[model samples]
Structure formats: C-alpha cells, structure tokens
Target chain A: MAYLDHAATTPMLPAALDAYATAARAIGNPSSLHAAGRSARRMVEESRERIAAVIGARPSEVIFTGGGTEADNLATKGVFWARRDADPGRRRVVVSAVEHHAVLDAVGWLGRHEGAEVTYLPVDGTGRVDPAGFAELVRAHGDETAVVSVQWANNEVGTVQPIAELAALAAGAGIPFHTDAVQAVGQVPVDFAGSGVAALTLTGHKLGGPVGVGALVLGRDVACTPLLHGGGQERDVRSGTLDTPGVVAFAVAVETTVRAREQYAERVAALRDELVRRVLAAVPDAIHNGDAEHRLPGNAHFSFPGCEGDALLLLLDAKGIYCSTGSACSAGVAQPSHVLLAMGADDARARSSLRFSLGHDSTEADLDALLAALPGAVERARRAGAWKTPR
Target chain B: MSGGVDSAVAAARAKDAGHDVTGVHLALARNPQTYRTGARGCCTLEDSRDARRAADVIGIPFYVWDMADEFHASVVDDFVDEYAAGRTPNPCLRCNEKIKFAAVLDRAVALGFDAVVTGHHARLGADGLLRRSVDLAKDQSYVLAVLTRAQLDRAVFPLGDSTKERVRAEAAERGLAVADKPDSHDICFIADGDTRGFLEGRLGSAPGDIVDGRTGARLGTHNGAYGYTIGQRKGLNLRVPAEDGRPRYVLSITPVTNTVTVGPREDLEVDTVTATRPIWHEASASVRCDVQLRAHGEVVPASVTVAAGELTARLETPARGVAAGQAIVAYRPDPGGDIVLGSATITAGTRESAHA
Candidate 1:
C-alpha cells in the first residue's frame, strides 16, 4: 500500500520507539522526591532541554501537554483569557481565516461563549495571509485585540504564512501572537526565538514520534491562564502528570527530524514535484492548489474539475493508494474545505480538492503507485458526478 | 448496512457468497443527533459506529452515503404533503421507493457497483420476481412493493430465507456486536413516536369541526384535520355521545372543508379502492389477486384492473381503514400469495353499500 497522507500522521521512527520503550521500563513519577522519582525527573528534564535546544527556545519556556490540540487550545484560549483578564479593553482576537480546526474552533469557542470579538484575517487566492491586511486591522482595533494567530503553515494546502511580519505587527501593537507550528517543525525551518512569536505549538506524531505528546513554547513574559488544573506542574501554567516515555520519544523524534530536515525536505520535495507534474500531465484539467513557491516541500494539493474528493479518495483507497480529502467530515459526510473556500474557491472547487503529503519514508515507488491509480479514479469519479443531486 | 443485526448478517452472507461487498449506512436524518438516541432508530452516531464496527468484523470496505437532503425532499416532504391533502401516507414505503431504490441505487450503479444489498426481509425468485420472505412474520415485501422492475433488478436482499430469530442467532455465531439489539419499531424519523405532534409541528393547527356522519351534529373540535387518520378510533375526545352509545371511528378527513367525519366502525369499511400512478412488475388488464393496503395491514382478495395509468380494485370482502395515499399492492392469490404483482397509490376508496 502507498500511504501519501503523512500530514495526517506519520509512522514513528525506530529511534523514538526505542527511546519510548527504554523510558517505559523506568518507574516513578517525576514529582515524587524518591530516587526513582529523581531518575524520572532527570529523564524528563533532559528531554525538555533537548526539545528546547532543537526548536530554538529556552528550556524553561517549553511547556509539555497531551498533544498538539491541547497545546493549540492552551495557546489560543489560554492567551486570550490571560490578556482579557489583564485589561478589560482587550476583548478582540485576530486570526487568519485558513487556520486548522485546532486553532479555528478554539477561537470560535472564545467568540461564542466568551465575549471575545473575533476578526478573521482573510488569505489570498494561494492561501497566504497578507501582512498589509494585518497592519490595517491592527491600526484599527489594536487596543481591543487580545491575540493574533496565524499558522506557520497550512496543513491542507501547505501555504507558509508571513509569520515574522505578522508577529512584528502584533509586537508593535503590544499584543501577544501565537502560531500553530505543528505542521512546520519537521517540514520546514522552525526557530521559536527567531520567529518572534510569543508562543508556538508542535506535536510529536506528525514528526514521527508517538501520539498524545506535544509542547507549547511560550515567551518568558507571556502570561497565560491554565486550561487544566491539577497537580501544579509545567511552571504552574499546565497541570498534569507528565508522560515520561512520551516526552522522551517526542524529544528524540524532534531532534532526529530537525537534524535531518534540510536533506529530508529536498528529497521529499523533489518526489512531490514529480508527483504533481505527472498527475497534471495525466489529467489535463486538474488544478494544483496552494502557493506555487511558498508551500511545504512535501505537500501537493489538486482539484479535479468535476470530481468529488470523497468519491475519488474512496476509489483510490480501493486501489490501495491512501490519501485525504483534506477536509472535516461530520458523520462521514464531507464538508467543503474551509481553507480552500477561504482561498476564494467555490464550494464545488473546495469539495473537489485532495491533499497528498509526502514524508521521510516516501519514495518514487509510492508516487508511481499513486499515478497508476489516480487517472482511473478521477475518470470514474467524474462519471459518478454524485457530489450534487440534480433537482 | 443499517447498523442492525439483519443488515450486518446480510453483508456477511454476501461476502461469504464470494461477491465483493461494501457496507454502506445511509445518513437519512438531517440532524443526526435527534435520531436513535438509545438505539431505537437508524442514522444516529451510535448506529454509524455500530455499522463501522460490523463492517470491520465482516472484513469489507465501509462508507456512509449522505442521503439526508434527498430523503427530506422526496420522502419527508411528500409525507407532509400527502397528509395535508387528507391522506394517510406510509413514509417507510416512500423511503424505499425514492431513497433506497432510486437515489441510492442510481448513485451506486454510477459509481461502478452493480447492485445495492439491503437487509429487507424479502426475496427475488430465480425468475427475478419479487417474493415475500419465508419468515412471514418479518416480511417487508409490502413496503418494498413500490420498487419498479428495473430497481428490483439491481437490488439484493440476503435475509429472505431465514427467520429474524435465525438471523439474530447467525449474528451471534458470527460474533457481531448487534446480535441482541432490539428491532427498530414505529417511524424511524419520528423520534418520540408521536406522529400527531410531528405533523402538528410541520402543519400548524388549523382548528376544525369533528361532526357525526349520521346526525351531522358537531361532536367535538379537532386542532388539525391532518392529525386524524381514517379508521382511527382513539383520541377523538368527542363531547357528544352517539344515540346508540357506540364508539365512533374517523370515517373521512376533508382538508378543503376543514372537517373530520366520525361514525360507527362499519362505516370505515370500503369494498372499492381507486388508485393512480401504478407501478407493475407484471401488468395485466384484469386479474384476481390479494391486495395489501398498508405496511402491515391484512390482505384481502380483489379483482384488480389497470387502464389509463390508473388501477381500480374491487374487494371480494370489504377491508376497513383503507386510507387514501396508502399503497395498494397486488399479490398472487394465496396459497401462493407471496409473489408481488404490482402496486399503486390509493387515491380514493368507497363503500359499496353507500353506492347501493
């Protein structure tokens, strides 16, 4: 089987697996003061320092959580609550429209339940948030805006945002900015300190570690409220018993992937470009989505004019080629990609798109398998035309 | 699969028979949260999970085809409209005709699948004729009688030979999780089983008079004429008692007049039923057959004639509660009455005594 959906989740690296197994054999909670506790604490501290060093953050700033979603919620909701509590005037949140549900839904909850007024910063046709638009929004409601969030890279289309410029605007306005860098750390160059963002989110599974482990990198001065309250841990901002094995595995995967990122990106990006080229050649009407230049190296997205992405994905699945529609499904019914819709595509175009993300393990053979099955799947799906019922 | 034991077993049996089977659950409810709250209906999230698990155990590819919009437009809307027109419609029959066989089948065939396999307790004889299930107690051929020959040709039912008990036993033997799940009863879409409340929500109360058929005296007031069905004997709450002190049954509902006429139970009997929009598996000018008027209603011997796209059937013995908008499905006269010959939508029914 050819698995081209690494952006969803990739397989764990052998090194990370070994680190997890080794840590699992150890006993005691890091909070317990006994010898076993101290040993566990040492392991946890070492893993924190390794992750901090690799991601260009100080050891004290790295706050471990259950996973990327928790980190994102902690960053979005935590920061919003903290800012609003500090000043009653700060009741607005500014975020890009194309953020993943992890960030979008959190901010949406803030808007609905909390009194946070949200301003969705629109992206261009290629899914990039323009810096000028951010500047205008800041110039208008800078004082009321509690936080600004734009992802480092979109998971669906792979369009890298102007995070540095957006962060600079937020800083000038004296507002805290957060970026969901879960899809960027292992796929691109992510330096927490260099990016100038107040907080960043990264998960382990997406970069070849175990699931259910991730971290939030926060600036020293950023005051954030805690989402979880129990057993005061992680500098009193996040409270929970740390998963020692998971933290060790996550750190090992982060270090290993970051060290090999440059070479890995080049190899996978070349394969992705070829896959895109051959796919477009085979199906002439297929449209490639996302920024041509400012995209993640291993990401390739396309829209087949008259095809339903779900039907095409199933057809490909039948042929042993796995990919994604890159959209949320409610009760197995595909909802049009909000990212694509935000990029100015119509509902049909949004529903017609598919995402194929290559990983460190991708090869020419995988791309060959996809190309062999794609043309037939597209033709059959177009013929099906079951996306919209004729009245 | 419907996330029930029968469909799950049907999927397994089809796979066991060496046909490439794909399990599919239909998302029929617009808002699925309102459906099957505690496993009494289909299309709920729990049911979807059950179906997915069953598919996993059966070892086949599974998908959920969203037919919510089509179902609302075709079955739900048609049901409300029929009721508004003073007719008692069977929504399950309409769903089988418009959704399962037409909309879903068309899409399946277009997607390269030759047929759709459902768990309806019905059979297709070797001659490709629609037949009642051997398990007569669980027979669904009445509801399925609406399918055309073309639709029936592309449909497969795998649980016709076995009883519901046998199907449940097979499910347990196969280690299926839904072996003990209770069978879904009443209308699946009507969550509380209150058809009156459901209709009232859609067609708001148009207060009307309930009059006695013989005396022409107003007996009571009804909130809406559509809430009362022909042959309904309960919930009348009549203010006046008949001179003979006999219980009254709903005889007719006239929407235009906004009136419901109630009389003795014998007045609800009809010997002649006029129907339209006839769908036939085997068309005939005139034939002696047994006709079923509603989903589980008893069949009566009738002489059925077809002409000008209309069907007129005269029953040998009068049938009570033969409501308009219910399907009149003709079957071969028993001892071989299991074979479905044709079906039509009842437009009107009249008592021979009234004409005499």
Candidate 2:
C-alpha cells in the first residue's frame, strides 16, 4: 500500500522504536527516589536535555505532556490564565484563523466560558499570517491582550508562517506568544530560543516517535499556569507521571530527524514537486494550494474541481493508495477545511481538496502508485459530483 | 445498516453468500445527540458504534454515510409541511422513498457498488417484483412501496425471509453485539416520541375551534388544527358531553378554516380513497387489489382505477380512519396478497353515503 498521509502521523523510526522497547523492559517510576527510580529519572532528564539541545531550549523549558493537543491546551489556556491573573484587564486573545483545532478549540473554550474576547487575525490567500496586520492589532489592543498564538506551519496546506516576525510584534506589546509547532520541528529548522516565541508545542508521533507523548517549550521568564494539578511534576506547569519510554523514544526521534532534516527535506521536496507537476498535467483543472516557496518539504495539497474529496479518498483506498481530505470529520460528516476556507476558497473548493504528504520512507515508487490510481478515481468522483438534495 | 439485529444479521448473511458486502450506516441526524437521546432512536453515536462493531465481527468494512442534508430537505421538511396542511404523513415512507433509496442508492451506484443492501423487512424477488415479508408482523413493504422499479432493482433486503426472532438468533450466534438491541420503533428522528410536541415547536400554536360535525356547534377549542388526526379518540378535551353521551372521534381537520370536526366513530369510515403521484411496479387501467391505508393498518379489499397520475381505490368493505398524506399501497388479491402492485399519496377519502 502507498501511504501518502504522513502529515497526519508518520511511521515511527526504527531507532525510536528500539529506545521505546528497551525502556519499556525496565521498571520504576521517574517520580520515585529509589535506585531503580533514579535510573528511570536519569533517562527521563537525559531525554529532556536531548530534546532541549536539539530545539534550542534549556532543559527546564521542555515540559513533557501527553501529546501535542495537551501541550497546545496547556500553553493556550495556561498562558491566558497566567496573564489574566497577573493583570485582570488582560482578557483578550489574538489568534490566527488557520490554526489547527488543538489551539483553536482551546481558545474557543476560553471565549465561550471564560469571558475572553478573541480576535481572529486573518491570513492571506496563501494561508500565511501577515505580521503587519498583527502589528496593527497589537498597537490597538496591546494592553488588554493576554496572549497571541499563530501556528508555525499549517497542517492542512503546509504553508509556513512568519513566526519570528509575529513573535516580535507580540513581544513588543508584552504579551506572551505561542506557536503550535507540531508540524514544523522535523520538517523545517525550528530553534526555540532564536524564534523568540515565549512558548511552542511539539509532539512525538508527527515526528518519528511513539504516540501520546509531547513537550511544550516555554521560555524561562514566561509565567504560565498549570492545566493539570497533580504530583507537581514538569516544574509544576504540567503534572503527570513522566512517560519515560515515550520521552526517550521522542528524544531519539527528534535528534535523528533534526540532524538529517536538510538532506531529508531536499529528497522529499523533490518527490513532492514531481507529484504536483504530474498531477496537474494529468488533471488540468486541478489547483495546487498553499504558497509555492513557503511550504513544508513533503506536503502537496490540491483541489480537483467538481469532485468530493471523500469520494476520491475512498476510490483511491480501494486501489491500495491512502491519503487525506485534510478536513475535520464530525460524526463521519466531512466538514469543509477551515484552512482552505481561510485561504479564500469557497465551501465547494474547500471540500474538494486533498492532502498528500510524503515522509521519511516515501519514494518515487509511492508517487507512481498514487499517480497511477488518481486519474481513474478522479473520473469516478467527478461523476458522483457533489451531493445535491433532490427537490 | 440501522444498528439493529435485523440489519446486522442481513449484512452477515450477505457476506456469507460470498458477495463483497460493505456495511454502511447512514448518519441521518445532523447532531446525533439532539436527534436520538439514548438507545431509543436510530442514527445516534451509540448506534453508529454498534453498527461498526457488528461490521467488525462480520469482518467487513463499514462506513457512516452522512445523509443529513438530504434527509432534512426531503423527509423532515415534508413532514412539517404535511402537518401544516392538516395531514398525518408517515415520515418513514417519505424517508424510504427519498433518502435510503434515491439519494444513497444513486451515490452507491456512482461509486461503483452493484447495489445497496438494507435491513428493511421487504422482499425484492429475483424477477424484480417487490413483495411482503413472510413475517407479517414486521412487514415493511408498505413503507417501501414508494420506491420506483429502478430503485428496487438495485436494492437488496436479506432479512425479508426470516422472522425478527430468527434474525436476532442469527445475530447472537454470529457474535454481533446488537443481537438484543431493541427494535427501533415510531419516528427515529422524534427523540422523545412526542409527535405533537415536536410539531408544535415547528408550527406554533394556532388556536382553533373543535366543532361537532352534525350539529355544527362548537364542542371545544384546540391549540392547533394540526394536532388532531382523523379517528383520534383521545385528548379531545371537549368541555361538553355528546347528546347521546357517546365518545366522539376526530372526523376531519380543515387547516384553512382552522377547525377540527368531531362526530360518532362511524363517521370515520371511508369507502373511497383518492390518491395522487402514483408509483407503480405494474400499472393497469383497473385492478382488483387489497389496500393498506397506513403503516400496520388492516389490509382491505378494493377495486382501484388509475388515470392521469392519480389512483382511486373503492373499498369493497369500508375502512375506518384513513387519513390524507398517508400512502395508499395496493397489493395483489389475498389468498396470499404478497406482491406490491403500486402506491400513491392519499389526497382525499370520502364516505359513499355522502357522495350518494
């Protein structure tokens, strides 16, 4: 089977798997102080340091959580509560419209129940947030704003944002900025300290590690409240028993992926470009989405006119080719991609789009498999067209 | 699949028959929590999960097809409109006609599937004629009669030959989790089974007088004319007793006049049922047949005539409480009246004595 949906979650690296298995055989919680516990604790701290060194953060700044969603929730809610507690007047949150549901829903909850006035900054047609528009918002409501969030890269369209510039604007206004860098760490160069963001979120599974483990990289001076309150772990910002095996596996994956990112990016980006060229040639009306120059290396998203993405996905699945529609499904109902809608596509165009993301193991043979199956699938899906309620 | 014993067993049987069967559960509810409150309704999240689990045990791929838009436009809206017109419409018939057969079947065929296999207790014979299930208590041929020959040609109902008890036994034997799940009854979309309250929320209160049919005297006041159905004997709430001191049943509801007419129960009997928009498997100028007025209503012998897309059935023995908006389904003459001849939407029903 050809797996082209790596952006959703890539396969685990072999070294990371070995690390997880080796750690799993050992026993004792990192929180315990006995000899076995100290051994486990050493492994956890070393993993934290390794992740910190690679991401350009201090060891204390890397607070491990359950996963990317948890890290995003911790950063968004935690930073908002901390800022609001510091100054009661700080009740406004500024976020980009193209953020994944992890940050979007967390901020949405705060707005719905916590009396937060949210300002959703719009993106350009390429799904990139403009620093100038954000600068204007900061100048207008700088004092009242508790936090600012803009993702480093969009998961759906793979459009990389101007995070350093946006972070500077938020810093100038004295508001903490957070970026959900879950999709960026191993694909592009991510330097936590150099990016100048107060906090950032990264997960393990998206990179080549085990699931259910991730870290929130917060600056030393960033005062953030805790989302979880038990066991006083991870410097009191996150409080769960450390997942030692997952953490070790995550660190191993991070180090290996980051070290080889330059070469990996070149190889996958070449394959992705070939895919985009061939698909457009095969189906002339198909529109490639996202900024050509500022996209993730392995990401290629397209909109096939007059076709429902779900129908195409199913047809391709029958041919042993797997991909995604890059939209959230609620109770099996395919919602139009908010990222595509934010990029100025209509509802039909948003629903018609599909995402094909190559990964570490992806090769030309996988692309050939997709190209072979895509034309027939598109024809069948076009025949199905959009579902119209018969009058 | 409907996440019930019959559908689960049907899917298993189809797979056992060596067809490439893929189970599909229609996500008819837009918001499932609001649609089905608990285990009482179909298309709930729990129902979808149950369907998926059954598919896993049967070892087939399963998908939930979101048909919420089509369902609302065709079934739900038509239901409210029919009531506003003072008619008691069977939403299940409308759902089968528009959604399960038309929209879903079209999509399935477009996706290269040979046919749609549903759990309805109706037989589609190899000769392409629709027939009643062997189990009369659970026969759904009346609801499915609205489907055209084209739709029925691509439809498969595997549970038609077996009784509900046998289907449940098969499900249990096959290790399906929903073997004992309660058969979904009433309207699946009406979560609480309060049809009046549901209609009242949509078409708000329009107070009208309840008048005696013979005397033309006002007997009581009703919140809305749509709330009363023909032949309803309960909840009339009449302030005055009848002259003969017998209970009065609802005879007619006139939405334009905003009035409900009540009289003796015998007045509910109608000898002729005139229906429009006939869908026929076998059409003729006239046919002697048996007609069903509503779901689970008695089958009565009738002589039916077809003309200009309308059908009029004159019952040999008059039937009681036949309402407009209900389907008039004709079947073959009955030593065994199993074959479905045709169906149409009832527009009017008149007593023979009134016409005479």
Candidate 3:
C-alpha cells in the first residue's frame, strides 16, 4: 500500500504509542486537587514544556486544546473577539486566501455573525503570500483591523509563506498575527518566539502524535478569549480537563519529530522529489504546482491536464494508492481549489489538482507502487472527460 | 441510494451477494436542507447521513456525489421550461433518465466500476428486459421507463423482488436506522408540498385570463397560467359553475396567450396523445402496450406507434388528466406482470371533445 496523504495525517511513532499506553494506565484528571491529580498535572506540564522547547515558545504559552481545529478556532476567534472587545472599532479581519478551513471558516464566522469586515490576502501563482502585499493590506486597514492570519505553509500546495516578514510586519502594525502551523510544525523549522506571531497552531496527528491533542502556542502578553468556558484551564484560553495520555503522546511525537527534523526532511524530500519527477516523466502534461525551492520537504502537488482529480484518486485507491484532491466539494461535484484559484489558476486547473505528501514511513517502494498505477489511471480519467452529464 | 429502508436493504443484499460494492447517495440539491423535507426529498443532509450509516453497518464505502449542477440543468431547468411552455413535466423520470442513469452511471463506469447499483423497486429480467417489481404497488418501472437499454445494462436494483414492507423489515433485522423511516412521498423538489408557491418563486407572476374553452366565456383570472395543470380542479378559485351546473376543470394552459382554458370534466379526457423525445428500451414500429400517464396514476390499454423521435398512443378508452410535457410510458403486460418498453414526453393531445 502506498499512502501518500501524510499531510492529512501520519502514522503515530512507536515512542508516542508507548507514552500513550503508559499515561492512560494512570488515574486522575489534571484539574483535581489530589495526589493523583498532581502527578497528572506534572505530566501535563512536562509535556507542555517539552512541546514549547521544541517549537521555540515559553512553557506557559503552550495552551493545549482538542486538536488543530480547536487550536485554530481559539487563535482566530479567541484573539479576534478579545481584540474587538478591547477596542470596539477593531472589526476587520485580514487573512490569507490559502488558509485551512479551520482558520478560514472561523474568520468567516466572525465576518458573518460578528459583523467584522473580512478581507482575504491573495497569493501568487505558487500559492505563496507576498509579504509586502499582506503588510500593505494590514496597514490600509489600520485601526479597523482586529487580526491578521496567514499559514506557515499551505496544506494542499505546500507553498511556504514568508512568515517572519509577514508576522513581524503585522506586529509592527500593532495587530496580532496568527499562523496556522498545523502543516508546518514538523515539516519545517517552526519557532514561536522567532516568528514574531502572537499565536501559532500545531496539532499532533499531522506529524506522528495521537489524534485529538494539539496546542495553541499563544504569546504571554497577548489577550485572547476562550472558546470553551469550563474549569478555566490552559490560561483561560481553552478549557476542559487536559487529555493526560494524549498530551504525553503528543509531546513525545513533537519532540521526536522536531529533533529529527533536518534528517527526516532531507530523506522525505528526496523521496518526494523522486515521486514528482517520475510522475511528470510518465505523464508529461502533469503540471507540478507550488514553489520548488520554498515548500515543505515532504510535499509534491500536481494538476494533470484533462483529468478530474476525484476520478484519478479513486482509480489509484482501487490499486491501494491513497492520496488527496486539493479541491473541496459540495455534494459530489468537486469545487475548484480556493488556494489554486487564489494563486490565479482557472477552474479546470484547480479541479485537476492532487496532493501527495511523504512522511517518516514513506519509501521508494511506495513511490514504485504509485508510478505503476498512475499512468493508466490518468488515461482513463482523461477519457472520462470532466464529469459533465452524459447527454 | 436514497438512504431509505429499501436502499439500505438493497446495499445489504448486494454486499451479501459477494460483489464488491460501494454505496453512493446522489446529491441533487444545490443546498442541503433548504427544501422542506417530509417523507420524500431529492437531497437532504439527513438522508446522506442515513445512507452513510447504512454503509457502515454493511461494511461498504459510502459517498455523496454532488450531481446538483447536472440536476439543475437537466431536471430543474427542464421543469421550469416545461411549465413556462404550458406542459406538466415529470422531474422524477428526468432524474432517473439523466442523473442516476447518465451522469452517475457514466462516472462509475469510468472509475472502473462494472455497474451502478441502486434501491429502485424494479426488476431486470433474465432475458435482459426491464420488468415490473414483485411488489407491484411499489413498482417504479413507470418513472424508469425513460432509461434506455444501455442504462439498464449497468443498473442494479437489489430490492426488485422484495416488497417495501419486507425491505423495511430486513433493515430492522440488520440494525439499520432508516428501517422505520417513512418512504418518500410527493415531489422531492417541492418540499413544502406547495407546488404553486414554488413555481411562483421561479416563474414569477404573470396575470392571465381564465376562459371557458367551449363557450369562450371569461370565468376569472389567474396569477400565472403555468401554475395550473390539465384536469386540475383546485387553485383556479373560479366562483361560477359550468353551463349544466357541473364543476369546472382546467382543460388546457396556453402560456403564449397567457390563457387558461377551463371547461367540463369531459374536456380533460384525451383519446390520442402525442409524445416527443422518445427513448425505447427495445425498438419497435408498433406495439399493443399498457400506457401510464401520471406516475402511480393508472395503466390503460393503448396501441402505440414509435417513430424516430416521437411516440403516438391511442388509448383503448380515453384517459383523463393527460397533459402535455408529462411522460407517456409504454409497457407490455407480461403473464406475471408488465415489462417497461420505453417512454416519451407528451407534446400534444386530442381531447375527447375534439374527437367527438
């Protein structure tokens, strides 16, 4: 089986699994004020410190949440609401056009339900946000801006953003910047303090940790509202009893993935490059997307001409090669990729795009299996034509 | 799959038959839950979820394919156009013809699936003919008559032999949630059961004269001529009775003149009906067939003549409520039941009064 959808979620590392089993066997919620609770709290704190150290943030700034989505919701809504409350005039939300649905939908909710003026910063042909363009938008909004958000790298296209430049510019503009680093954190060098962003969202499952455990590395001085109000945990930004086992497993995965970042990226990038090169070689018209030099080491995205992505994906799935389409959909009709469209791709190009991401488990054999199935699948999909109703 | 008890049981039966199966719910609406849902709806989020649930129980992969764009173009747009052209369109038949059999089946075959399976209540005979389902009351061969032989070749109806009650019972036995879910009723698109309100929103109001067809006496006015169908006795709101003190019935709607012709009930009866856009299951120049006018309305003996693009059927006895733009499906009455031959959309009709 060739699993190329690592950006969706990777298999948990052995160390994380062991940590989870060990932590789960222990008793007591971290919120309880007893001996067992103290032990649990210690484990949670140690996990937080370990995660913070690896991601370049203070231990106190690590606010654990359910997962990447919750962390993103906390960052977008939490900061936007807090900033709007502090200054009623701050009603504009500026985010990049390529952000994940977590940040995009949350910011959209603010626009629709909370009466905020939402603006999406566009991307270039490579799906990268121009630092200058974003800074200009933030400056123009000025006092009306509640928050600015741009991801470290796009999940679908893997185009890395000029994060430090954009975040520092937003910081200079006196508006908090939030980066959804869910796809960036183990794939690239992520530093909370160095990036100059008020909030960064990272989840475990995307790397190798247990699902349903993630953290929002919020700034100490940043005032953010809590999404869930209960037990007043996680600096009052995120509430609910911490998943002691899940947190332990998540921290181990983060520490391990971060520690091996350079070597892992080198190996996975080589595999990804081979897959991209061979796929293009076999299917000559397949156009590779994203910035080659400035992308996640494990990511390669492409759009095959005259082929619908869903049909191709299903054909590959039949042969046990799992990948993902960059395009979202309503009902069964594939909607063009918002990121690709923002990057100036037409509907046809966006509809034909697919993403294949490598990880710690990806190998040459996996790529071999993919190449074997791809050529025929592309041929069949092309012959099918773009899912138009057969008259 | 519609995510109903019949479909759930169909999926279960297909899985049990050992063919590799994947269940899909065709999403025919642009927006989910926008239409008022009763027992029946074209596409609802709840139905999609229920289908997925049944798939989980049956251990087959499930997906909801968004065919809304195709549905809008083929079914929804045609519906409005037919009404605007003063014809009563059969959206259900159009859906079966274009959506399930064409758009969806084409995609499935391209994606390497041998056939597209559904929970439709119709049987495929061993001799490669489309036959009425064992559960005759639930037989949907009338709507399916629009499907060509190519569609029937790759279509599977797992609940063909089972009654609706038996399908529901099997679903309950299999622990499916939609076992007790009511069978869909009325038109799926018209959620509130208010066809006029739905039509007014789309066609817009066009005031027109409602006149007596025979005597040429102006009866009343109508908001829009398209809002009335042939043989419709309600929604005209005309106060005066006919010449013989008989009730009034809408005999014809002429959108060009924006005039609705109402007369005695006998005027609504038609002996010869001319239908266009013919699709034949098996080609024949002429045949003695059982003709169904409205869906689940009735089947009457008719002699049908088939041409390249048209079908003309002369009913043994004139049938009432025969309207243009509706489907006139031809079927051969088998010893066991009836076999669906093909169908055409009604384009013209010779009323009993004209014949007399």
Report the lDDT tens digits of candidate 1 across residue range B59-165: 99998877788888988888889999999999899988888888878777767889889999988756788888888889999999889888988989988888999
Badly placed stretches (over 4 Å) of model 3 are A329-333, A389-391, B34-36, B281-284, B351-356
Encode model 3's per-residue lDDT on A1-391: one tens digit a residue: 9999999999999999999999999998998899999999999999999999999999999999999999899888988999999999999998999999999999999989998889998888998888888767876786889888899999999999999999888888898899999999888999999989999999999989999999999999999988899888888777898999999999999999999999999999988889999999999999999999899998999999998887788788878999999666554556788988898988888888899989999999999999999999999998776467435
Best by DockQ: 2
Worst 10 residues of 2 chain B by lDDT: B33-42
Interface RMSD of every predicted model, in angstroms: 2.0, 1.7, 2.6
Descending-DockQ candidate ranking: 2, 1, 3
Candidate 3 residue B160 C-alpha distance from true site, Å: 2.2
lDDT of 2 by residue, A1-391 (tens): 9999999999999999999999999997999999999999999999999999999999999999999999999999999999999999999998999999999999999999998998999999999998888999999999999999899999999999999999998998889999999999999999999999999999999999999999999998999999999998899898989999999999999999999999999999999999999999999999999999999999999999989898888889888898999999765668899999988999999989999999999999998999899998899888777455465
Query: Candidate 3, residues B204-316: lDDT per residue as tens digits?
Result: 99999999999898889999998999989977888677768888898999988999999888777888989998888766679998899988888899899988788999988
In order, what lDDT does every prediction score? 0.91, 0.91, 0.87
Tens digit of per-residue lDDT, candidate 1, span A1-391: 9999999999999999999999999998999999999999999999999999999999999999999999999999999999999998899998899998999999999999999898999999999999998999999999999988899999999999989889999999999999999999988999999989999999999999999999999998999999999987898999999999999999999999999999999998999999999999999999999998898998999999999898898899988999999998777878889999999999999989999999989999998999899988898888777635733
TM-score of each: 0.97, 0.98, 0.96
Clashing residue pairs found in predicted model 3: A331-B66, A332-B65, A332-B66, B39-B184
Query: Which lDDT tens digits does candidate 2 get at residues B1-356?
Result: 87788888888988998898878889888778733454466788778888889999999877778888889999999999999999999999998888888888888778888888888898886778788988899999999999988888888899888888888888889999998887787888888889899999999999999999999999999999999899999999999999999999999999999999999988888999999999977757699989999999999999999899899999988888989999999998533328999999999989876532
RMSD to truth, every model: 1.7, 1.6, 2.1
